[model samples]
Target chain A: MSDVSSRDRKQSWFYTDIVKEHFFHPKNFMDRDVATDEYDATGKVGSPACGDELRVWLKVDPGSERIREFRWKTFGCGSAIASTSVASVMVTENGGMTLEEARALKPMDIMNRLGGLPARKFHCSVLCDKALRDAINDFYRRAGRFDRIVVEASRVVDLVAKVTDHDIEEAVLEGAHTLEAVQQKTKVGIGNPGVLPAVEDLIRFYREKYFG
Target chain B: MATRHVYLDHAAAAPLDSRVLRSMRPFLEGAGGNPSSFHGDGKEAKDALDDARTRIASLIHARPDEILFTSGGTESDNLAVLGYARANKANGCHLVTSAFEHPAVLESVGHLEKKEGFTATYVSPGRDGIVSADDAIAAVRPDTVLVSVMLANNEIGTIQPVADIGKRLKKLREAGHTKAVLHTDACQGAGAMELDVEKLRVELLTINGGKIYGPKGIGALYAKRGVKLQPLQFGGTQERGIRPGTENVAGAVGLATALEISSEIREAENARLIALRDTLIGGLLARVPKSRLNGHATLRLPNNANLSFLDMEGEALLLYLDAAGIEASTGSACTSAALEPSHVILSLGLPYEVAHGSLRFSLGRATTEADVDYVLDTLPPLVQKLRAISPVRVDEKYYV
Candidate 1:
């Protein structure tokens, strides 16, 4: 409490003016009614329960295999929304990016383009790149290339105890009714309170299905 | 694009009223010397302080000497809870409070329980976020020495049954149980409700100037005569030595002036605010599907409407609303920056995501029908836009 000044704490919660501008006026967010088939591939990352989730869809031209258009949907904070907004613009700025160029796009590139996010919200930038990579993986999967399926270890519930969503589900199946009960069963949220939001979501999800 | 910046976060703090400023100008500029001094300038200052005290005392139906000035509502709250508990410790160390109390009261009660040898009972609110009198009464023990409840919740705007709770405690004392002091943080309610402390049956009541369009630095605690209290601070004997600091003369004048004006105009302003509040609440619920009103529909503060927009993060929605010049609060004003979902909302048995998706729009003197219409016009499209990008499926009956 002594380390952080009240003014600094208040300022840290705000996005840079540029980030706010992009967030308020996002570039190419997907329409809810847009058909799944409209995009060549789709990539998804994070979970709503984790308090951040993003999905990116890309329409690639068959001739050049260059990404012709990008659209996305996200359930996250201001930084995550702004990061996704800027990333979409970065990838589609000069007519389009070749699939390789899109693949090379990094979280730093997105963060730098948006001025910057708060240090605690750096993970929001990371989610933008992960979602894009997942989209590329989807692009490969749709082209009958089973070998290109990059099974990134994205399914993590507790980083400290190395607990996964599957483990949380198993514990819930054994009648873990609350977050505390699930922690007793699988030690999911005990190590990281940061992950408890996600853990709580999974507990509810599983309990609704199994207990109901 | 509308350039008008509509302020609807009045519960966070209201802009100081111009009338209050006019009342405070002489005290700020020419009214010199400390109220404690005995010189000519000091006599002038003392007169101002005495006049302010009388006006403030009259506003709440208390005698002038019962009012003790502190920095603000937080200090007033700290004084009432900590002071009362410590002074009466020989009698008992038991305290009672609601689970949804503001942090000032909560943290003070927390410190007493953790560091001081005190026991506490936290009564949870009913589903509508109102503390039931029965629940509060049931939590009272024979040894309970202090019961602190806010007159109105700052976040959800739910008015507690503080009067009823006070009556019950009055009964308990009449029955020869421990003489527990009933305290209410009337910071948020002083502007919106009737605040006759004697009528409310509260022994100690808190009022801050900021929420009532007075100055920000001044708050007053009304301790009923003969209520034993230990000072939280020590220095020269100001505020009867309970809060020993040089009196903020201009602040006292501003606070008293604000209170006097509030009582004069409360009825008309309350009617106007209640109408605007209903329009905003009704419009949002009607225009935005899946939007749910938080807190008790009828028992809430007239100017407050807390609503949860399904499938959108509150901070994200707040930014969108902020961009459109519609200022609002997500959760309590103090903790909104910390970004944890509101514990007050969660205490109402709301799912966390629903809590996370909530916004509080508190109308004030500046709010107009046009402002309400502008918000109704602006907010629905933004909610639609956010829901489009949201990963949480509204159809997932579990999330709702």
Candidate 2:
């Protein structure tokens, strides 16, 4: 028998303010009228047998990008519930970063806030944060205006560059038919230079690059 | 509006009362002398130890001297089963116990069979999770030295008729066979239920601190004065040489304090818990279809509500509920982590999927009607969500 445990049992691991708050008065968790910018993610933590689950919700803005609102739904330990309680403030107050960034958060910050979690259940804090991020990602995906897109715009400078690239073309080129036929029979649409042939080549390039 | 935090799952462990805490403080801070030492300090410690023994004995209706303080239920069970099996090996090695016994008993029995030359019979409980005294009596061979049964199951909270089993053993002893001893791990029963050893007729009993809201890491084994159990450890003459080394006076005081308070509250707690427990359980059954309650409902503990939701993993539901801010357990906690079906549920012959999804809610002092209501309101949707994702599914063919 280990006569004395390191912790004072009189003040059980459950007596801490955070544990009581989590176990007694959890906050920020009614989502019926929650907004669209909620950084959506899915949190499916705990085992198939242990029966603990946590889902967190965070709403960050694209402009000033501060967490506008935060909430969660937790179904397990007091520490896990407290983790959500503490995490909501952490993510929302810290200028709500990207959902991915929130997903990557660590639990030590929560440990510091809640005093600390029981050594056996440190994962509850991690689950809380992960659930929030998962919900955030899920929320955005549902919104359609979620992923960022980048496309190129055209300019006249590119058109001039294309003309210069054909100046040193091959010696013999075709018109109307094959380049060999043009060379053997007659000069067709070889503009005073080779504008028509260059246009045809440009059309083929465009077709291969995009239209195809 | 405000709500109460439902404190179900008390069978997991309970909260110590102010009275218990008040009784424990002095021992933890002041009563620091070694009971083995023979000074004024030692005398004070010895007196305190005696007081705890007497209190524990009074709760169980056993003799004070029979109480051999150990650490907790696991140690007491090991000392009782392994110690007795090893000591009486010459008499015969056949031991019989139920399949739904706590791991403390089942695992220890396994060690004796594997390490020592002993044969064990694992009796099965019926579909209602009740073991017949006749069945256990029948398993008792002429050579059998011991029979260990739990007063109440820790997970499902099925209260085994250990008193009845003890009576049968007593009858057998009165006729001829006097070698066999009956032991029960009553750590779960000590607090919320009556624990009169004389009424139960148990020769050896297991009582632990943590389960009864005392400090953890302390417990006692009740070894009837003449019941021979081999010593598992050796060091000093402490605890009558049965358990050696320096004693845990603080823990004992705390345990005694907790036990005393628990005894006082037993009746009131039982009534309150049963009423709230029925609501928590009955609500789930009514709201969630295709869910089954495991174990004998009325014969079970006042606070125990073990349920098996069809076509789902208890862990998945647990995680879902966790996110929802409702605390609960899935059968045995460690068994849940293993992702394997619980041995208790499996012993009941449930399908592996149902076994995997078994949940137990043990209500305690902190539990409230609001908490029960919260669970009732929150759980079924979670079950539905999980059923949607279950790999091993149940539809019209399986939902009964």
Residue-level lDDT of model 2, residues A1-212, one tens digit each, is 01111122322243367666654455676434445443433333333223334555555565653556776665443455567777777776655655556655666777777877554345322466545544655655665656621111222111211212221222122222333232212121211233446544644554444435
Chain A only, candidate 2, TM-score: 0.51
Each candidate: RMSD to true structure? 7.6, 20.5
10 residues in a row with least lDDT, candidate 2 chain B: B331-340
lDDT of 1 by residue, B1-400 (tens): 5488998888888899999999999988885689889899999999999999999998889999999999999999999999999999877899999998888899899999999989999999977889999988888888899999999998889999998999988999999886787999999999989899878999999999998999998999999999989998898888888889899999999999999888899899989999999999999999998888999888999999999887877777777777788888674211233334577877887765676677889899988999999999999999888888776774446334
User: After superposition, which runs of candidate 2 have C-alpha atoms over 4 Å from their true positions?
Assistant: A1-212, B1-5, B332-337, B395-400
Candidate 1 ranges beyond 4 A from true positions: A1-14, A34-41, A47-50, A59-69, A92-106, A124-126, A133-155, A159-212, B332-335, B395-400
Docking class of 1: incorrect
Give lDDT: candidate 1, residue B332: 21
lDDT (tens digit, per residue) of candidate 1 on A30-94: 87666777789998875544355688899988778788889998876677888898889888888
How much does each candidate deviate at the interface, measured as C-alpha RMSD after superposition?
Answer: 7.3, 23.2
- Give the winner by lDDT: 1
